[model samples]
Target: MAAPDRPAGGGRMLTGVTWAVLLLGLWLWGRDITDGSGGPAPTTGDVAAVGRPIGVRLPPAHAPLRAAVPERVEIPSVGISAPVVPRGLDRGGGIEPPSFDTPQTVGWYDGGTKPGAAGAALLVGHVDTETRPAVFYPLSAAHPGEQVRVVRSDGSVAEFTIDDVQVFTREHFDAQKAYGPRKDGRAELRLITCGGTYDRATREYTANVVVSAYLTGGSGAAA
Candidate 1:
């Protein structure tokens, strides 16, 4: 994900032996994941990709925010339903991800817009941890029109529909685009995780898979 001090986020790691085994599996014909470049963790004001919109286009929402805290997040399409943890800046001033020990957890950037608020809300997770896939391993497969629900502590769910899911290389990561509003004044969401191939030399994925979505319907949504 393209955010402020990104190196501090997406803490998923693979030991040399583990990565080698995974790469060997890849060599036998498997999914292609890229190697990632080091950067500041993704911040809301950070991503803005240059060029044509790589994500799907969608209309803005007229709904207002009805909840301030998010509890759980569910993506039935991918069989993902996990706890949502509010994360803040790390010592390096980057968005921090949940510890790798809890690979099923997802982290939302507290400094950015809330999930149901009008703006881009970032939800980050690891595509895979050192030994296996994590909560967002299937994130890249999320398609347009799929539902992504965020259960709020207020007992309301903020629902979103996937609009776009694209992979951005670390070198070409547009902080503005990755974290920016796909459409002005829309209550949008960005689900990000490491993707592409792992680089043995750099010890990170080369690209990121970012899923863009917008508020659709939810009990917490404004009427």
Candidate 2:
């Protein structure tokens, strides 16, 4: 979640999306955060969007409004199969990704919208580890039309289709665009990681890879 250099202690009020990549580092093999350059991203505590509930999913067809929890994420196209965990902002206000020891898994921003629910849900992982490429190394190559599946708690998989694959540089990062919904009413997902070149001097990557997707249709059976 750190910025370009992601230096600790800058007291800058980065938009919600901006802070996510703003501080998640300390030798990230593949960090997730493009940059923090745009306007404010409405944030209400853990909820990334303002006025959202404790959890907002695209309303269940016949099930209760409260959806199941996310257990794991699978992207067959890129062969990313990893457990999902919850992440939150650190003392510095940057998103806190899972530790380097858990490189095999990804972290979901629990404070934000839950995956498959309404609003934009965020999932972040290391593109690489200190020793090698981590779970999200192939993120940059992700294209539109790919299928992203999220296995949830209530016995269902929330499937989303890729809409856009982009790389946001430190100078051009926008929190709202990165973490907001594509339309006024829809469920969206954001897969993020550090991309481009790594700056040894700054200890952070110059660009961040952001993969955007939206809930289309999914199977009834929950995994």
Candidate topping TM-score = 1
Question: In model 1, which regions exceed 4 Å deviation?
Answer: 1-62, 220-223
lDDT of 1 by residue, 69-175 (tens): 77789999978899999887556445666778888899887766778888778788766665556788777667776889988877778889887766665554546
Q: Estimate every model's Cα lDDT from 0 to 1.
A: 0.64, 0.61
TM-score of every candidate relative to the true structure? 0.72, 0.70
The per-prediction tally of clashing pairs is 31, 23
lDDT of 1: 0.64
- Give the Å error, residue 88, model 2: 2.2
- Please give the TM-score that candidate 2 achieves against the real structure: 0.70
Q: Which one is best on lDDT?
A: 1
Q: What is the C-alpha RMSD of each candidate to the true structure, in Å?
A: 11.7, 11.5
